[model samples]
Target: MHLFAMLRLILLGTTLLFSLITLGLAANLVDKLGDQWSFPGFAVAVSVLTILAVVPMIVIDLLRRGALMSWVVVELPIMGILWVLWLSSAALSTSVGLFLGDCSSFSFDSALESLCRQYSALQAFSWLNWLLVKTYVIVTLALAILALMKGHKRVWFSPVSDLSFSPTHTHSGEPKIPPPATAPGGYNPDPRMAHNHSASPSSGYPPNQPPTLYSPPSGQYPPQQQPYQSPYPNQGPAQYGSPVQTYQSPPPHAAQV
Candidate 1:
């Protein structure tokens, strides 16, 4: 019991730690957004929208709520935001539209001097940090998301009091009860199916279908008997070339009699 409690605590701590880190990244991204805004083209538009969507979700993840924290509640949105940042960064390369004067021709000292002109302190600065910094930031953001996903998940309840728990299913090492039969949840019924489906497999009729009378295929009926004929004397031998004859006639049940 203590071992389980320890594992859960570790998971909770990791989840919260990732949340804090992602929060920091979100703020940094928001600040960097301003630097990218002046760039022309559609990537800027996408970058703006992505940053806008990401910041609030990160804030929500950082903010405390009454409900218990879970993967979907706290980490799912942050992971999605990280993916968006990955994609948007590709679309908006750091080299474009920052108005950073070309430092290619400047010597190391000359470049540092230009920084004063741009930032009211030096002559210039090198943008070599642009690629490496963004790459590092993205990698950390991805790791935080990964750690959040790897953390243990707890039920939305107070941990103080508990009875025995019998789980029907487990996902990612976490015990879970199967969803309610008819609820709109992970185990929900298909929307295209009928509502009155039978709960028992031994039902008389197929589930969701009304009872139907079975019909045999054409030509599958039993063989029918023909009427019996009586062999009697030919009254007149109408053709005159045939003999008049009389014979014993069998009864209806006489075939075996």
Candidate 2:
């Protein structure tokens, strides 16, 4: 469990880093492009769009992965995306304020300038951000729509718990189906009923065997026929230091009547 938690933490950290980088790039693009580029508000919209688009998919993916901490994994990506969006918004607002000369101009460090300058060189970076955001939105909506249309299917990738848990017939609050019936010619095995039956001839039986039939002695009157014949009459009962033939009989007077 501890190991699972640690793994979840690591995945969370990675997602956070991914979000931070995505937002950082977007912000830098906005800073360089300026408000005159005519799509200044697009980055904020895209950031929002990305969050709405990716979160549920990430949740579903984590669930499908069978993560022990799946909820945590889902939440981490969501929080990361939100953080990125928030950061991007802050950065864009600051840049816009500077552009309008309504706020104090902050000098960029060498690294910050380098990053912004990289984005500025591409007149297409602003469009690229919008494109990415739109693509994410479209794909996510398609997936969600597909899910709704399918109406909770029993997909192999889906969790077994989500599939049909209802019993077709119930017994004792569990699905009821008689245990597979014994094979037709097979012995009924019961350990506690206590009979010594063996699997091989050396072990007093043979594979796929039928029990040996006992033959009556030549002049023993063929034993009196009992009113009730035993199903396993060939299997004699232990008696008098030897096996004896036994069968069920009616009470004596009742039989005579």
Residue-wise C-alpha lDDT for candidate 1, range 1-257, written one tens digit per residue = 44423433343344334333333433443354554443223333433443454444334434643323323334334444444543444335343433355554345566444432332211011122123224433443444334335432343132211112222224463545444466443345543343443454433343466667679897899778898875654465366667645566788897987
Q: Rate the local accuracy (lDDT) of all candidates.
A: 0.39, 0.43
Evaluate model 2: give its lDDT. 0.43
Q: Please list the residue runs of candidate 1 whose C-alpha ends up more than 4 Å from where it truly belongs after superposition.
A: 1-43, 61-63, 66-78, 91-102, 106-257
In TM-score terms, candidate 1 sits at 0.24
Clash pairs detected, candidate 2: 200-205
The candidate scoring highest on TM-score is 2
Cα TM-score of candidate 2: 0.27
Task: After the best TM-score superposition of candidate 1, give how far the Cα of residue 95 lies from its true spot, in angstroms.
Answer: 8.9
